[model samples]
Target: MQQIAIAQAAEGMVLAKDVETGDNRILCGKGTALSAAIIERFRRMDISHITVEGHPVVEEGAKSLKEELLDVENRFSKVRHIKPLLYLKKRIQERLIASRRPQPAAKSEGS
Candidate 1:
C-alpha cells in the first residue's frame, strides 16, 4: 500500500485505508475502488492525498530513492551517536524506503 496525492489518483484504484475529513468524518471506507465521481468528490472536499492499495504515484521531478536515502542519512549524521535519535533515524529510513518502493499498478477497467 502507498499514499499518493489526490491529484495523482486515478479511477479504479482501491483505497488501502479509510479517508476522513478534517473534523474526523469518514468520507470513504478502506478497500473502496475509486471512480471518477468519487475522485471528483474528494477534490471538492479539498482532500490532498489518500492511501491506495498499489504502487506509489511518483510525482514529476521527484527524488530517486538513493538520493532520498542519502539525504536522510546526511540529515541525521550529526546525531547518529545518540541512542534515541539513532532509533528515530532508523524508523524514518524504513518509512522512506516503503514510500518510495514501486508496486503493481491498481487494476483498471481495461484490465
Candidate 2:
C-alpha cells in the first residue's frame, strides 16, 4: 500500500486503510474504490492524504525488473565463463526478481 496526497488520489483506486477525520471519525472505510466526486469531497474536508492499495504510482527514471536484471547480467558478463560467478549472478537475479514482486502489507494493530 502507498500513502499518497489527496491530489494524487485517482478514481478507482482502493483504500488500503480507513480514512479518518482529525477527530478519528472514519470518512471512508478500507477497501473503498474511490470515485471522482468522493475524492473532491475529501479535498473539501481538508483530508491531506490517504493510504491506497498497491504501488500504482511509477516514478520517472525507475528501472523495471527486466531492466535491472539485464544490468546485473551485463556487470557480470566478463566473468560469465567462471562457474562460481555464473552461480552468483543467477542468485542475484533471483533475489532481484523476488524483491520486485509485491509484498503483503503488514497488518496493523487496529485491524
Candidate 3:
C-alpha cells in the first residue's frame, strides 16, 4: 500500500486502511473505493494523508533513495558543524529512506 497526501488521492482508488477524523471517528472504512464525494469530504476535513491499496504515485526518472540521501547530505553540508542542525538533518534523511521503503502486504485470513 502507498500512503499518499490528500491532494494526490483520486477517484476509484481502494483504501487500504480506515480514514478517521481527528477525534478518532472513522470517516471511511478499509477497502472502500474512493469517489469524488469522498475525496471532496477528505479535502474539506483537511486530512493530510491516507494509505491506499497500491502505488498510485508515479516517479518517472526520479532520483533513487540513495541519490536523495546524498542530495540531503549535500544540502546540509554548510550546517553540518552545528550539532542540533546536524541531528535534524540526520533525522530527516532517515525519515526519507523509511518513507521510500516498500511496505509489506497485509495478511489475509486465508493466508
Every candidate's CA RMSD? 4.7, 7.0, 6.8
Q: Judged by lDDT, which candidate is best?
A: 1
The model with the greatest TM-score is: 1
Regions more than 4 Å wrong, model 1: 1-7, 20-25, 35-55, 102-111
TM-scores for all candidates?
0.58, 0.56, 0.54
Give a tens-digit lDDT track for model 2, residues 1-111. 677899898877778889998999998888777878779989999999898876666657977778989999899989958999899999999887765454444433233
lDDT tens digits, residues 18-52, model 3? 99998999988887777778888899999989988
Error of 3 at 27 (Å): 0.5
Cα error, residue 16 of model 1, in Å, equals 4.5
Candidate 2, superposed: residue stretches over 4 Å from native: 60-111
Give me the overall lDDT of model 1: 0.80
